[model samples]
Target: MEDNHIHSISSKSACKVTDDICLPDTNWPRLVIVGGGFAGLALVEKLKNKKVQVVLFDKNNFHQFQPLLYQVATSALEPDSIVFPFRKQFNGYKNVVFRLAVVEEIQPTSNIVRTNKGDVHYDYLVLATGTTTNFFGMDTVADNSLGMKDIRDSLNIRHMMLQNLEQAAITCDDEERDTLTNFVIVGGGPAGVEMAGALAEFCKYILPKDYPEYPSTIMNIYLIEARGELLSSMSDKASSKTLKYLEDLNVNVLLNESVSNYDGSKVITNRDNIIMAKNLIWTAGVKGQFPKGIDKKYVVRGNRIKTNPFLMVEDYKNIFAIGDIAAVITEKTPKGHPQVAQTAIQQGKYLGTSILNIIKNKPIKPFEYHDKGSLATVGKRKAVADLGKFRFGGYFAWLLWSIVHLMSISGFRNRLMVGFNWAVSYFTYEKSNRLIIRNFNKPSESKSTINSQPAVKKITIND
Candidate 1:
């Protein structure tokens, strides 16, 4: 880090101490978790009352269920459903303590983790920090586009979409209004597809009732996929069906078309064409959010940390990585498992049992991934499901998808709320909670602060 980039520093430091009372002698085999996402929460949940004392920490105080995050971003669901409070989840539980802290560094040699608040020693560490939305090494994409990783990002996207529609009404120029009304969702994967569908539905049902001045056709929703089809992970028939459903909903599904550039207004794709857009929802891909001090050699494709079949890091005993962060390399499975919540949950269960086995000097079992199949929703009465021998699309698929998701949700209250919301939306063709919150921020509006100039390298908190 360069000194020129350093700002607002204090020359002197203060040290405060209690009544010289010695710190509580921590129990042996202290497990420190860096994140509170899918994998980290699962790990602690499995070992809620185990021998090891668990200290789970995250920047935010909640565990965000990412699959439903797109719905939150598109204003289909409230924030409470997607985000589960970490403390509330572990309340009155023994051997588990949740801490809110920003993890700054991981000193693996010393078996310690540092944070903005303080440092803690760990007998074993689990790096389940999960993955961030991959912008494909494009700086402009990182800076200009809206990422759908966290709740704040989701709410910001929702606000931006609504604000653009409102702004479109007052604008006199038709060109400017069109630009504001148009929305481009990069990556035709499940997140992109869901968002595109929600936005398209908004245009059909919500917009007509609210913005009578703007017709449904005038508000265009474009889904850009670099691949030849959407939901490429699903069956070929499912992909075709999803495309058909999207096309019927009036979403422009642009397949095999890569976006070349986005200057916050015009999104130039491939060559010879450009789409005037306001919102650029980026859900392209994800790379592991590896914590510091892990050996660079262990980091493999997708920036994932390599692990053994036992879910332990290759060169280390005791230390383990799971969820989206760990890449288990095997002859049968090469590219690690898909970074899904279910895989993480299962891995956490296995790893917790494995830890118990290790303590008892018992043989550890290999972690095997169960294929429960994958399903995604495209709006009311529309979805696709792939279950190996069983593959389906359209209305029945949507019902199955809803039931599965509702049952899979973390808590009972959440499942009930989401169920109610879906039921109402299904019947009315309306998505409630479209109200915009917080200070105004838009995807099209350039934040000069983030793009001011070449940031003179600084040793910030992330460093």
Candidate 2:
């Protein structure tokens, strides 16, 4: 087969093709990747400048560093700091191209993907679409509470918190003030724990200084977990230490309790315990997110696509999945690999080489996951880590967490921005991005639903 065996519409004549996204003419096998999260980007990195022409499709053009999204939500860093443009990442990589479009459907039979912009054919397809916030089919909770799944969610949390605090200041009634100031974080996972810790810090360090009228205890931080302990995925030591860390920070750790319902202002737990809070952040669960056209038979628990050990969807040789969307089911691992950055990165890189070998008809081995340990931070100078035969917490663990995350960010400039902010906050306890530039309204309800419901009273600034 020669290089020109496959002919693509030239750049000048791309408009003539109906329902097709304009792409550079290429003879190399086109690898169409959906989503640009950890796994997809890893594959992109591995295949850059390779013989395969890669077309990366994502709704957002930037790659977000998810582990630190809590910081962004808590205003420790800006959105731009955690996001890197795909074009900037692909600079000098001639074989790679990125398109900003939402994939609406996957037509495996036609070897094409239909996006909101246009359709594009693929020689091979990979789904790294990742997961979205899972509310367990609770519409009320889904509408009222904020999720920590993306940069937008983080921004929403930040705005919700700031606006609620401002409302707390405006109210005359004590009960309404309490409802406005209290914070409820559902889920005992790493995200919820980190968010609770960060909010606790905000209440402790930033509240009294920013608002002299209110005491430091005006804001209450509650962390609710359905599980018996925090960080259930980690070892017993790590879990215990994490609980201790949050407790010391005055976070109301509610273990063995689940949120039964939330009506925008009140949190009702399964035990019938009621907590009044206007700001609720949900980090409880996530389900696979991808375009339609995937057979329901291949879908498993958590809505993930079932794939073989080689990372190929069962019965579909040319279609594959990676990252959070992929559930590689095997006897040893009945569910799937952990939906973490490490698993996704490894899978992406593995599949990169695997795809090239596949094109060349070379043999490939089964996909195997190597556990790289887990790290979760409660707040500044506090974290827990679980490594092989070694579990630890406190300052040293926090240091390890910081170093690992700093090195894991996408770009050097982003790394620098985060490192600088962390350094300033490590000593000063400062969060620089607290300005409420925009009013945030929940997607599911009217703006009035989130407003403070107490009677308004007039008080002069000096009064």
- What CA RMSD would you report for each candidate? 9.8, 4.9
Worst lDDT run of 10 residues, candidate 1, spans 14-23
Evaluated at residue 123, the lDDT of candidate 1 is: 68
Model 1: residue 72 alpha-carbon error in angstroms: 1.4
Pairs of colliding residues, candidate 1: none
Sum up the clashes in candidate 2: 0
Which tens-of-lDDT digit does each residue in 34-146 have in candidate 1?
78877888788888876666778788988877888888987789999877788789986666777788877777777767778777777678888888888887766666788
lDDT of each candidate versus the true structure: 0.79, 0.88
Among all windows of 10 consecutive residues in model 2, the one with the lowest summed lDDT is 454-463
Model 2 C-alpha lDDT per residue in residues 1-463, reported as the tens digit of each score:
3446335423442322433788877667889999999999999999988888799999998999999999998889999999999999999898888999999998989888999998888889999999999999887788788889999989989998888888888989988988888888999999999999999999899999888888988788889999999999999999999999998998888899898777887677777677887888999999999999899999999999999999999989999999999999999889999999999999999999999888777898999999989999999899999988899999999999999999999999999999999999999999989988799985554334323433323211111
Each candidate's number of clashing pairs is: 0, 0
Best by TM-score: 2
